[model samples]
Target: MTVTTDRVHVYADEFDEVSRILARTTERVRLELIDGKLRSKAVPDGDHGRIIQWLLRICMQSRPELFLHPDQGLKVQAYRHGRARPDASLASNDAFVGQGEWADPGPVLMAVEVTSYDSDTDARDRVEKPRAYAETGIPVYLLIDRDTCEVTVYSEPDGVRYESARTVPFGKTVVLPGPVDIALETEQLKDWVH
Candidate 1:
């Protein structure tokens, strides 16, 4: 007889055994800590998923060192007792586990998050997440704007802050972290808007 093995969810109650002093708010959205502050952002739909899927597939086949994941939480000590879960995160390994419906992962080489329904939320994805990613020394951060059909890459982060930034439309695939060039059809993400 064939048997199935049980899997432990990454984002489940795994953190409960770690610390009871965690935050009280846990929404359906993504959550993370930055500079002693907690940020909770909403989830994405099909359109956003497509962009991420495209990026990951290209990235995996092109440059396999970095891993890509969406809505996976990273337990970060760099923040003021913060936990940042990005829409799409890149780990060093090819395969990853689950934390629940989400994944509580380690410090990836890079992180990605799609914009929420709010512009302010999108702006947060642009500024704060990049800042957090850089601060944590994640090295690279990518943002795909569904409403605007734009893809932005932030590199050369210095101490929880990135001094450099580049924004590109869907027409061009982005070359990131060396030897990895994948163009995002920005228009493809338009269907995911709210």
Candidate 2:
């Protein structure tokens, strides 16, 4: 998940609450877990950040109509289910209308999570997270793996799951839903690791 961002400020209470709950989760064996089941690498060493920043830049540049997002919470709450916040989410319309204590329906169009060193986190972001996103009916999901330096785009939901998708290497340019086209350089992205 993206942390330490610009524009949208994360409320400390929400952060603490989510974090406290995540501390008890057992599914996060040997992987980075933040705010209870919200799996993400702690802080990307160096290479990871570059890929993430580049994607962010590319998205904002192409889709001027969409909300430029950071690691902000969508703040969806049900009576018993609680709330979930993705690393970064893009909602097509004003889904956050008339939210008082917290947002409902969730602010989601596309959610992107850049994978860390851990393969499990990468898998979760690539698979389970996309499942959850599909369940919410979010249009697109993006997963960036800094280790292998690959980016995957998933779309076309089928029963709380993504059945149609495309996977692109950093060498190839991938065009997002909008006019945003970004080529993630796998070699350059892994430079810091070497």
Candidate 3:
């Protein structure tokens, strides 16, 4: 298997163990297994944290029944072999109850990612995550691109990929379609981007 980082090839189970160990050892690193490759997710900066906070507040107000979960690890991709920790996961308040570090994606209504300033952000967030989430049958994948100051809503997952994608600039409003039905007023997002 081709590795994304450090040229270390490991099975899915092995990656899980390594991730668990790392989680306990340090909060400085986060790992993910996608497309049979190991990858690292950068720690969020102040702006990244603020963006998640902004979305969390809006989600709570508009859809109190659902909660925005941060740093949620999920078993994704076809057959659930791939594991990913999305920036935030939108689901019922108790969706992840009784689950371990990596939960099944069945209860997830949406997976959110805010781009970081890392070099791998383009491949990891913009390309890989959408495909992984879609293949896992998650209904929505929300991408907040800080680099370009745009929000891309991906929906209608057909098990291989999302069939529809709508992108709007920072100041406009975007609707997160069914299952995660909420209109996001993104004018505030402008303040959070670089």
Winning model by TM-score = 3
Q: Considering TM-score, where higher is better, how would the candidates rank from best to worst?
A: 3, 1, 2
Query: Candidate 1 vs candidate 3: which has greater lDDT?
Result: 3
Q: Which candidate would rank higher by lDDT, 2 or 3?
A: 3
lDDT by residue for model 2 (68-146), tens: 4555444432222324445566654455555542344344667777776665665566656676666666667787766
Could you tell me the TM-score of candidate 2?
0.63
lDDT tens per residue, model 3, 1-194? 32245654557787877887777879999899998888888999999999999999999999999999999899887553888999999999999999988898899999999999999999999999999999999999999999999999999999899999999999999999998889998999889876
Candidate 1 vs candidate 2, lDDT winner:
1
Question: How many clashing residue pairs, candidate 2?
Answer: 2
Per-residue accuracy of model 1 over 1-194 as CA lDDT, tens digit each: 22112322223234332223333333443444544454446666666677688778877886677677666666553534446777777776643553543333444666787776764675477666777677776667888776667778887878757777888876665666532344444555555565
lDDT of 2: 0.55
Report the alpha-carbon TM-score of model 3 versus the true structure: 0.94
Reference-based lDDT, each prediction: 0.61, 0.55, 0.91
Q: In model 2, which regions exceed 4 Å deviation?
A: 1-41, 75-84, 92-107, 178-194
Question: Which pairs clash in model 2?
Answer: 22-36, 90-109
The reply for model 3, stretches above 4 Å from the true place, is: 1-9
